[model samples]
Target: ASPADMAHIAAANPAAVQGLLADLEAMAQELLAYRADSSLDTAGATIRAQAARIAELERDAARYRAMRDGLVSGDLENNPIGEAMYELGERVCRERGHDAIPTAAEFDAAIDTAMKQPTCTCPSGDGSLSWPCPQHPPEVT
Candidate 1:
């Protein structure tokens, strides 16, 4: 409604627009800096997470090695027992004319029979008893 007001606004409009543009430029620069900083932070977090994962994998590998060694040792210690079981299975197969690989029931029965049979303490070595009974250790050959 006022001519004087309109004239003043027209005179200041260019300078005001320039100031706004300068402010926008500054804000853009800040945004770029913030992006660079945030990317570095993200990279650090990723590296730390990966390192922890690698450590966990190493620990798991160690445990697996230990378990494998224990199983091998147990198998070694029990080999004689397994051999005895196989021997009994073989004798039954040969005498009865059955398959060499005995069934589970036959295997169990052979094991039970072997356990129940008398184990002679003599050094004859024919029985399943330990050689050189505690009472009479054989003279060292």
Candidate 2:
């Protein structure tokens, strides 16, 4: 109530004003007791724990996204060997026709076989063949 209303009530009945003040004081005490209780502290701890977990999950999601992008993009910074292998596989697929595109296991087996082949030395004494020999074109550099 406004001061004027309180004054009017006090003037009309001082006892009633005293009762109103007592009620207000009791309410204030109740509020103070509630604040002093441990429930608020427990609630705050729970909120903080949940917030920390959410932040950790967000960080994990970001890391996974970065890993997924790295794999899908085949960028040199993240997967240089994967990028090179993909390019070599793509070239092979194009040269042999799309219908003959190798499965993952087949491609791995083909790579293993190629790696096991003996290096071919050119018969010419010029020694012009590259490091891998005449089977592969001469290295440009």
Instruction: Highest lDDT: give the candidate number.
Output: 1
Error of 2 at 48 (Å): 0.4
> In candidate 1, where is summed lDDT lowest over 10 consecutive residues?
109-118
What are the per-residue Cα lDDT tens digits for candidate 1 across 58-129? 755654454455456777555433555668777878987776577666655544453343455565445556
Each candidate structure's count of clashing pairs: 0, 0
Q: How well does model 2 score by local distance difference test?
A: 0.64
Candidate 2 clashing pairs, residues 3+ apart or interchain: none
All candidates: TM-score: 0.41, 0.32
Report lDDT per candidate. 0.67, 0.64
Highest TM-score against the true fold, candidate: 1
lDDT of 2 by residue, 1-141 (tens): 999998887767968878888999999999888887768888999999999999977755654554465578856565533544566678778889766665665545443443333444656423552355554456721
TM-score of 2: 0.32
What 10-residue stretch in candidate 2 is worst by lDDT? 109-118
